[model samples]
Target: MNSAKLSHRSPTTDHGSQAFPKELASSVAISQSLEELGWIPRPKLLALRRLGIETVEDLLTHFPRRHEDRTEFPQFPREESDVPICLCGEVTKTSLRRFGGWRKIFEVTLQESNPNALSEPLVCRWFNLHYVQKMIATGQRMVVFGKPRLRGKRICMDHPEFEVIENDEEISIHFRRITPIYPATEGLSQRVLRGMIYRLLNELPSTDAGLERLTPSNLAKGERRDAIRAIHFPASWEARDAAHEHLVLTEFFAMQMLIASRRADASIRQGEKHCGAGALLDRLLKSLPFELTAAQSRVISEIRHDLAASHAMNRLLQGDVGSGKTAVAIAAMLLAVEGGYQAAFMAPTQILAEQHYDVLQRWLDPLGIRVALRTAARQEESGPLPLFEHAGNSERQEPQIIVGTHALLYDKVSFSKLGLVVVDEQHKFGVAQRAQLSAREPAPDVLVMTATPIPRTLTMTIYGDLDVSTID
Candidate 1:
C-alpha cells in the first residue's frame, strides 16, 4: 500500500470498486509536470520519468517499501552490522577507484553530521554502478541507509540508499522521527523520493481522503486520512498497522464483491445433467484391486452431487502426490460416458498425457472403454486426430475417452457429445484453454485438478466463481 498515495484516494482502483467522487479526482490535480518543481535537477528528473514518475500521482504512489526510525544516530561502525542503519553525514571526499582492468568503484567519504568527530569517516562504496559517480560530490550533505561492514581498514557500506540534502527544510524531513524509505531505481535516491512525498503530503488536505467507507467505522477504527498519514510517517508501528488495517479490509471487500458478481453470472446459465446411474463408475471401482482412500471417496461424493445437479459444475480438485486424483477423475469420466457422452482429459505436457493414456488404456481396455491419445508430436507422426477429423459426425469417432495435451484445443478437435473435461495441473493453461472443451450448447462439467497447494484466501479471490473440493 502506498501510504502517501492512500492520502490521495480510496482503494477503488486497486480492487475494481466503483469510481470515487469527483472531489477525489480534483485532489490529485497536483499531477502536473515535474518540470514545474525546481528542486529536482534536470538529469534526476529524467531518471524519475524513466521510473514512471512524470506526474504527481506517480510520484506519490511510488510507495515506500519500508520505513526506518531516524530519531537517533548510530556511531560509525568499527565492525560489521547485520541490520541496516540510517545515518546523516557530509561528503568529506569523493574518488573514482580502479581495481581489475575495466572494473571501477565510486567511493564517498562521509563524516558524521555532528561537529565533534568520534571515529574514522565511513567509506560508502558503489561498485560498477556508474550512475552513482554523477550524483555524489564532496561537501554535499546527505542521508544514507544500509548495513555497515568493515572492509580491510575502512568501515564500508555497499550500494546504500542515499539522498543529497538540498535545503534547510528537508533536513528535518530526512532526519527526525519515522522516515519512509522508497523503492528507488539505480539513479534515484530514497531521500529525494521521500522529500517529494513529504512536500506533497503537506500540500494535500488532512481530510478523510473522500473515501466511501467499505467497512463499518465500528469494525475498523480511524479515518482514511489518519490511515494515510500513519502509513508513511506513523507515530509507532502499531499506529501504522492500525492505519493500514482498514485499507486492507477495504481492498479485500471490493474483491469479494467482484467475485460475487462473477458467481451470479455463472449461475445464470442452467446446466444439463450429464451423469448417469453409477453402473459405469461402479464397474471401474470394482475393477480396481484397492479401495479408494477416505479423502478421495469424500471428494468423489461431492463431485457426483455437482454432476447430477442442474447447475454447471465449475470445481477445483486439489490433492498431494499419489493422493488418488487420477482415480477420482476416472470416476468422473466414467459417469459422463455412462450418460451416453464422451469425456476429454487434458494434461499440460506431452509426457504426462502419454503417461495418463497408458494408465487409462490398461484399466479401461478390459471394460471396453476405447481411449485415444492425441498430441502435437503424434499428429505430426501420424495423420489427423481421429476424434475431430470430421467432427460433426459421431459414427466415425470410436473413442469414448480422449486424452491429449494443448493439441486438444485445436478447432479441428470437437467432441461429438462432450460430457466432461478433466484438466490436470490446470494452472498451466489459460482461462480460455481450460473452458474451451465445455463451451457448447450443453455445458460439460469441468473438474480442474492441481497438486500445488493454493492459499485458501487466494482461491476465494482468484477462483471465487468455482466450487472447491479437496482430497486431503
Candidate 2:
C-alpha cells in the first residue's frame, strides 16, 4: 500500500498500536448502548443520540458525506475557476470591514506557504461572520477549499471550507492523506466527529456491527464488515469506490431479505375463502355499459385467485387514470358480498368517496345490491333493504357495499361481517389507519388500490407482503 502523506492518528487494518483490548466486553456486540462503553463523555453521548446514533453499529455506519484528497495541495489560482479547489497557504493579513449599515465582511489574505516568483496571494472572504474573524490570525498556516473568483485584481474564495493547520502536525486529523467531511450538527465540529469515528474503527470490532456477508460466492467482492471500515476511511481511491458499491448492494440485499420474510409470513396466516361462485360478479359485468378490457379481465382474475386463498387476501391493485380499475374493484367487492360478507370501500378524499357512491348506487340500486355513502360532511344511505341474516350475523339490513372517506373508521360505523376492505389511493393514509381497518375478527381481506405513479423498487419495498396485480 502507498503510505505517501498518510496519518499516524488512524488505526491500520492489522489493529495498529492504537488498538484497545477485546476485554472491553461492551464493545463486543454492535447493538450495545454507547453509554455502556463509558469512554464517551456525557455531553457527547447526548449529542450522538440526538442524531439517532445510540449504538456501536450506528457509529460505525456514520459514513462520511464525502472525502477530500489532501495528499497534495493544488497550486494557488492565478485566475478565476468555477470548480472548487483545495489549497494550503499561510495567512499574510486579516481585516474586518464594516459596510451597508452595520454589515461586516471578514477577509484573510493567504499566500502559498511555499510561494515561488509566479505565485499570487489568495483572499478568503466571509460575510457577516464575526466568529470567523476571531479564529483567524496572521502567520497561521491554513487549508482552504472553494471556488476562486477574481474580485478587483485579487483571486478570492467566498465562504470557503477551512481548517488551521496545527504547527505541530502529528495530532491533527484535518491535515495529510484523504480527509473525511461528515454531515455535522450544531454542537459537533468536523474535527471532533472525525476523531470519534476513527477511534471507534480501531477500538471496537467492526465485524460485530451485525452485518454479515450474505451475498453468494463470487457475487460480490468483499466481506461487508471490511466494507464498513473502508467506507469511513479508505486506504485508496479504488478501495473507497469498491466499498461504496459493496455497501449499496448490501443495502438492497437487506431490503430483499425483509421483503422475503414478510412474503413468507403472509403465506402462513390462515384465511377464509372470500370468493364466491361468480353469480353476483357475472350479473355486474353483464350490466356494465361497456365491456371489460383484456387487461382489466386479467387483473380481476388475479384478484379472484387471492380471494380464494386460505389466508386473508392482502393485495395491491395498480392502474393508470381512465383505466377500468373501479369496475374491477366493484367486481372484487361483489365476490366478497356473494360469499356472505360486507365490503367496505374507503377513498382518500370526501369528493372521491361521494363520486364512487354515486356510480355504485346508479349501477347497483336497480340490481338490488344496496350501496351507502358516508363522509365527514354527508351521510346518505339508500332506502332500507331486506335483512341479510345468516348464522351468527349481528347486523340486520346492513348495506352490502358502504363507500366512505376516513369516516369509515369512525365508531358509529359498524359492519355485520366485514370480509373485504378496499382502500382507494392507498398512499394518502397512514399505516395505522389502513391496518386498523383490517385488524378485526378473522381479519378482513385487504385490497388497497392506487393510481399514483410509483417507482417499481419502492412499490416492491412498501407492499412487499401483499400480492400485486397491475392492470397495465
Candidate 3:
C-alpha cells in the first residue's frame, strides 16, 4: 500500500551502466567477501551472479542436460543404424515452394563427404526451413548435426543444426568428437549467446577482486565453460565434449542447490492449525450421491493434516475428470467453516464458478449456511431481482462461502474473516495471480485443484515447492 516506495520508476537516468547498481553490489558484498575467504575468487563469484547464479555452493551444482559428439563426421553413408549422429556438412543448393496461404517449404542440398574419400559428396536434403535457403550459397561449407535417414537413393537430415562456417579451413580435423548443445531462445541464436558468454568470461579478470572462477572444483568448470564456448564455435569435437561435461554438471548442481535452499526455507516456516473431527466432513460427503473412494479419503486426510499443521497449507489436489476432486474440496470448505473462518472458491471460468455456486448452495443452504456467488455476469444477467443491487450494504456480514471466478478478488469484495482459498483448475490461472489470491487478508490457506493428471515425475519437478496430494 506504500505507493511512493513500491511504484515503478523509469530507469533512463540509471540505465547506462552495464552492471547491477552499486547499492545492490553493496548488499551482497558481505556474502561475496565471505565467498572469497572460502577460496572462491571474487571475479568468478560476480560473474556467476551476473548470469543469475548466486552462492559459492550454487556454482558447483550447475550441469548440462546432454552432450553432442562432434569428433567424427558421421556421414549419411557411414551412420550406424539406431545410433544418434551429429555432423557438419555443406549446403550446396537450396530451393523454396509456397504450398498455400502463408505456408512455405524449403528444399536444401547438403553435401556430406566420406572421410575415406574427401572428393566424393553424399547429397543430403532438408525440407521446410525456407529461411535457411537465404543463408546458403552454392559453395558455402556448413556444420549440420542431427539424425540422418536414408531416403531412397539419397540421405536426408531433418531439423539439423545448420550453420555457415567462414571457410573449409575453419573445419578442423579434430571436429569428430563429443559436443554440447545448450538450451537457447529465439532471436538469441546459440552461436550469438555463446559469443556473449565468451565475452563475459573474458571480462571476468576486470571484475571485483574476490570474484574469479565462475565454476567451482566440485564441477568441471573450466571444461564445461570451454565446451559451451567450443560447441557454439568449436574447432574440434573433443573440445566441445570437454566443455559440455563441465556445463551440464554446473547446470544440474545449480538446480539442486536451489531446491535444497527452498526445502530448508519451507522447513523453517510453520504451518497453521485447523484441527477438528470428521463430523462436518462426513455430513458433506454423505450429502453427495456416491461414496468416497479410498483414494479420495487418503487425499482428504493429507489435506486435513496440512490444515492442522503449524505452517500455512500450500497444497495441490490433482485428479482426472469426474474423479470427485470437487467433493474433496467441498469437504475442505466445510472444515474451514467449522473452524469459524470464511472460505472462497475461485474458478477460471464464469460458467464453472456458477456450477460450483449452485452445488455449494444446494448442499449448504439446508444447513442454514450463507453462500454467495459473485461473477462478472451478476451485473449483466436479466433477472427479477439483482441480489447485489438490492443487498443494501456492500460489505459481507456473515461467516459465509463465496464462489466465483476472479471477480471475488476485486478490491470491493472484502471478507469478514477469510481463511481458506480453493482455486479450481489452477493451470488456468497465472502463478502470480494465484499468489495474489492466497495473500488475501488473514492470508488464507491455499488448496489448488486441477483436473489434468500430470505425470508424477513432472509434477514433482515443476511443482516441488508446493505440497501435492494426487487423487489418482
Candidate 4:
C-alpha cells in the first residue's frame, strides 16, 4: 500500500527524522481540496463549485455527457429504429425550391457509393435554410445523422444534423473512435476542461489520491489507473469501452461496500421501540372518510416492525402521487405520541411544510392532538404558536406532531421526547440536515418519503443505507 498523507492540512507528515517532501503526492491527492489546486482563480473556482466539482475526487467522478462514436460509417440499407442513423454520402444534386412561391426550402440529394442503396436516394431537406443552398455543392462528401422518414417513394431525412468531411485524414483524428463530450458550465469550454484534466493526470503521482488502495482483487494497478486515464482521453474505441466497464463496476462496488458499513452500524445502534398502535391512531384511522389502501397497510406494517425493533429505523417509503404516504406517516407519528413521545414532520420548502401543517391540523386537532407549525417565514408572521400559549404547563406546551421546513433544525427548537421524524421529499435535505433533526435524546426512528420513483441503480447508490418499501 502506498503511504499517502491522510491528513487534510499537513500534506507531508514527518516520517522518522527525515521530513517527507511535498511533491506529486500532495498535488493530486484526493485529500487535497480544490482550494489547493492553486491554478484556479476565485471566479473560476466558484463556477466549478456551482457545477458540484469541489474536490479532486469530485472532478474525477464528473463523467462524460455522451461519447460520440466517430468510428466506421453505417452499413448500407439502414434499418428503422428509434436511434438516429448516421451515413456518409456525396451530395449528387442541390436545388432551391419554393412552396406557393413564398415558403423557401433547400433540398440536397445524397447518394452512397454502395450499390445496396435502399431507395432512389436519401433526400436531405431544410426548411427556410437559405445558407445551406450555398454550403452544399454537387460533389461534397458529408456525414448526416437523423431519423429517416418515407417521403412519397424516396427515403428522406428532414433537417438532419451534419458536418462536412473536409479531408481523408480527418477520419482517423475525429471519426475513427469514441470522443467524449463533458458537461461544462458557462465560460468553461470543453477544450479548456479537457486540457486541465490532462495536466492533472500527467502531474498525478503514483501514490496520489490512494487510487491503488481501491483497486480490487480482480483489477490490477494498470487496469484501474488506465481506466481512469482512458475514460478522459481514450486511444481507441476498445479502450474506451473497457474503461467504461471498469469505472461503472467500481462505482457499484463502492456503493455496496458503503451499504455494508452502514448495515454494521445499524446493527449496534440503539433505538426506541414504540410498538403499540394505540387509541389515537385507531381513532384517526376510523374517522377518515376513506379506507386505507392495501399498499398503505403493507407499508404501515413495515414501519410498525421497524418501530418495534431495538435498532434505529432508517427506511425510505416510495410511492406515486396519491399512494397515501402521508397517512402512513401520520400513523407512525401517532405511535410515537402513544409512547409518550413527540414526533416531527419535515418538508423541503415552506409552502410544503405549511400544506402538511394545514392537512394534519384538521385531522389531529379534532382528536385533541397538539400540532405546531414552524418555518423561517412563520417567525416573522404574527406571534407564537398555540402550543406555546400554554407555556405554564410543560405537558400542554409540547406538540405531539411538529410540522416544519428546515427551520425545525434551528438551535432554539426543542422537543419533549422526539421519537419519530418523517421527512417529505427526502431528497431535498442533505445527510447532515437530516441528522440534525434525528439528533436528540434516544435517537429517533426516521421515515423518509419520496413521491418520485428512483431507478433501482440510483436507489442502491444513494439510499442504500435505508431499508426501502415501495407502495406501487
Candidate 5:
C-alpha cells in the first residue's frame, strides 16, 4: 500500500477491534518513501529506481522467484539424492586457488561449533564467480545449500546457494522457512533488499487497529495483513503459497476493475467519427516505394475502424523494430486530415521528432499538408517557433500534422482541431505528459505507438485501459 492508503482505516472494520493505536500506525506510513527509510543512500535509491522500485509498496510486490529451504542442516549424506543439504557455520579458512591457466577456484572451509555434529570441517568451493572470494569473510556465519560430495573424506560442495548471515536476527529471518530469493540488478544485492524489507516490516504497525485501517475492504482484515507480512518472511511453504494467492488475486482484480472502468468511460465519452479512407490516404500509399506488410495492413484496418467509431480512440499500437510503425501512424493521421481536423504526432526525443518530420514531410508535402517540427532544438536554432511566429497575425495558423517532443505541451503551441494524437515510443513519455498532450484537444483520438514488442499478457496488465493492435 502507498502512504496515502495506509493512513486510513477500512470503513468495514470496527474501530473497537484495532490492534494498534492510530498515532503509531501513522508513523509507519510516514516511512513509505525510500528516503524516509534512512538506511538507503542517494546512490542506492537511484539504483533502486532503475530496477522499478520507488516506494515501499514496489519493494513488497517484488516477490521471490524461488525459495531456499534451510529449516534444518542434515548429516553428511550416505547416498546421492535430488534434495540438496543445508549447512550453517562460520568460515574458518578461505582462499583462491588456480586450477588451470584460465580457471580459478574459490574455496572456503566452514567449521561448525558443535564438533560432535560433523567428522571434520565442511569445505565449500565456487568456480568462476570470483566475487564469492571477497564476499565470504573469515569468522562470518554462512548457510550453504547444495548437494555435498564426499571428496576423499572431506565434505565439499561446489557453487552452493550460500548466504553470509550477518547476525542472530538475520539467521532467524533466513532460516525461518522457504526463504524468498528476489530478482535483483547488478549494484542492488538481494541481501540489501531483504534487509530493507525486514526493517520496514519490523517498524510497521502490527496492532489489529493499524492493520484494519491499512487493508482494503474486500480483503479480510487481519488475514490479508498477515499474508502481506508472510510473503516477505514466511514460516513454511504452505504459508507462503497461501499469502501469494491473495496477493496474486488482488493484482488480477485490480486489472479487471481498471479494464471495466475504461470500458465504462469509453461508453460515456463522445468522439468524432472520421470519414473512410479517401484520395489522400490512397495517393500516399501509392506514392510509397514499397508495399505494406500483412501485419501492418491488418493493424491499419483495426485503427481505421476505431477512428470511424463515435468515441475517442484510446488504442496502443505495438510493433517490433523495422516493422513500418511510422507508415501506419501516417495513415492514421491522414484519416484526421481527411475529416478536416488537425493532428499532432508527439515523439520522446527532439532527434526523433526531426526524423519523423523529415519522413512525414516527404510523404505529405506533395499533398499540400503542412507538416512542421516544433522541438526545443528547432525553436532555439530558427528563432521563434511556428506557433509563436503566427501569434501576432490576425488569422491563427497551425500545421496539419505537428511533430515535436514535450514542446508540444507548451502554452504557445495550439492546435486548430487536433482530431488525433500519435505518441511514438509511448513508454518513454510519462503519463502526465501524454495526458497533457491529449488534453490539448477535446477528447482527441489517441494512437500510442511503441517500437518494442511486449508479451500479450503483460501488455494487457500494463496497458489494459487501451485497445491493443500489434503488428508482428
Candidate 6:
C-alpha cells in the first residue's frame, strides 16, 4: 500500500483517539432546563454544533429575521380584494381524503350579523389545513385570520392563521399584530422550534447577566426579557415588536463584533513578506492564455497591497467555479518568488496538488523559476525520476515554488525563505490545520481560496472575522 494513501485516511476512521463522550453534557443541561420550564426541548447542542453553532452566545445570536402575525382574527373586509383579510369564524363541517396528501381543505360556516341584526351564514373554505380540520372534528371553536375573497359567491381562504378556542377561553377581535418566525432545519418545523424556544425561555435564569446584557439601556432589563417571553407566547402585538427589535439588534451587533475581532487579529499581526510589483507580475500576465478579468485584477491589487503592508495578509478569495481564481493565486506566488521568497501552494487532494504543480512548472519554468512537485505519488513512482526519495534525503533545499497536498506541512520539508502560503479550496481543511499552516516560522502571509459563491449576507454572517476578497 502506498504511504500517501495510508497517511490520507480520515481521522474518524482511526480508533486511536480517545472516544468522544456518549452524550454532550451541555445538551443534557439544556434539555433538563427546557423540561423544567415546560418548553419543547431543542435539538442537542452537539448536534447544533455539527450545524456550526458552538456556544450559548451563538445560540442567542441566531435571531429571526422576519415575523408572521397570528395573534388575532380581524373581521373579514366587506369589500372584495386579493389582499388577505382577517376574519373570525367557526368550522361547521370537516372531511379528509385518502392519498390526497397531508394537507386538507376545510369548509366552514361563518355566523355574522349584518346592520339589520339578522343572522346570516357565509360559506368560508380553508385549503390544506389538515390540523385545523382535525381540531374542528373535535367540535372546537376557532378564530381564523386570513385574506378573504369571494370564490363563486362563497368566501374562501387558501392558507390562513387559525387558533382553536375552547369553551372556557375568550376570543379577541383585533388586527395589525406581529409575531416572530424562527429559522428551522428540515425535520424541525417552525411550530416545533417555537415550542422549544418557549421551553428554553422558561428555563432561563431570571438573574442571568446574559439577558441583562442583551437588554438595551433604553428599555428596562426586566421589561426587555419580559418582551422576549411574551413574543414566544404573545398577549399583544406591541409586545412582539418590542421583543423582535431587541433580539435582532442583539444578533446583528454580536455578529459585527465577531467580524471586527477577526479583522483586528488579521491586521495587527505581522507576517512574512515577499513583495513584488509590476515588473514580475507583468511578465507572468503576458504569458497567460487569457486576460485577467476586472474582478481578478481588483483582487490581485488587494492581495498585493496586503503583501506590501507591514502587517501580514490573511484574506479569503471567493469565486464561482471556473472563475479563473487559480490564475490569480499563481500570479501572487510568482510575486513572492520575485521578491526572493519561497511560496507554498497547498491543495486538499493529491490529484489537485499534482495538477497545480504541473501548471505552476509550465508557467514558471519558462521564466527560469525553479518549481517542485511533492506528493505521495512521487514516493511510489517507478521511473528514473524518484522525486519523493530525493526529497526524503533531508539535504534538498525548498524549491522556489513548493506544490503539494498536506505533505507541505510535514516536518522534514523546510523552506529557505517562506513568505507566502496559498491554500486552495480552503473550506475542505479544518480550522486547526489552517492554524498550523499559519504558525510556520516567520509566519507566511496566508491567502485562502474557495470556488463556492456564497451570498453577501451569508458571507458577512458566517465568516465575518475572515478578511474576504470576492472575484465575481
lDDT of 2 by residue, 270-302 (tens): 668888899988888888888999999998898
lDDT of 1 by residue, 1-472 (tens): 0111112222222222212224322233344667765667888888897888886656755656787766556666677889988777789999998989989989999987654544668889999988889888888977788999988888899999787867674566655556677767756667667766766655554353443366677777766545555666665566657766866876677778888896796687777897889897888898899999999999999998988988788899988989999999999998888888888999999999999998888888777787888888863211234645455665544578899999999877767888888999999999888767667777778899999988898887888988998888
Whole-structure CA lDDT of model 5: 0.74
Off by over 4 Å in 2: 1-28, 79-82, 102-104, 128-141, 150-152, 164-172, 206-211, 346-416, 427-441, 452-464
Candidate 5 ranges beyond 4 A from true positions: 1-66, 74-86, 94-108, 112-140, 145-222, 270-279, 285-302, 308-310, 319-324, 348-352, 379-396, 406-416, 425-432, 451-459, 470-472
The full ranking of all candidates by TM-score, starting with the best, is 2, 1, 5, 4, 3, 6
Model 3 C-alpha lDDT per residue in residues 392-453, reported as the tens digit of each score: 65553554688888887677676877778899999999987887766654456789999887
Ranking by lDDT: 2, 1, 5, 4, 6, 3
TM-score of each model, in listed order: 0.76, 0.80, 0.63, 0.65, 0.65, 0.59
Computed on alpha carbons, the lDDT of every model, listed in order, comes to 0.76, 0.80, 0.61, 0.73, 0.74, 0.62
- lDDT string for model 5 (243-289, tens) is 67777766677667878797688666888786445679999989889
Clashes of each: 0, 2, 45, 1, 6, 4
lDDT of 6 by residue, 304-341 (tens): 98788777778889999899889989888878888888
Worst 10 residues of 3 by lDDT: 1-10
Please report the candidate that would top lDDT against the real structure: 2
Model 3 reaches what TM-score against the true structure? 0.63
**Which whole-number lDDT from 0 to 100 does residue 85 have in model 4?**
69
TM-score-better candidate, 2 vs 5: 2
Per TM-score, the best of the predicted structures is 2
Model 3: runs farther than 4 Å from truth? 1-71, 75-84, 87-120, 124-131, 146-152, 156-160, 168-191, 206-311, 318-323, 375-399, 408-412, 427-430, 450-472
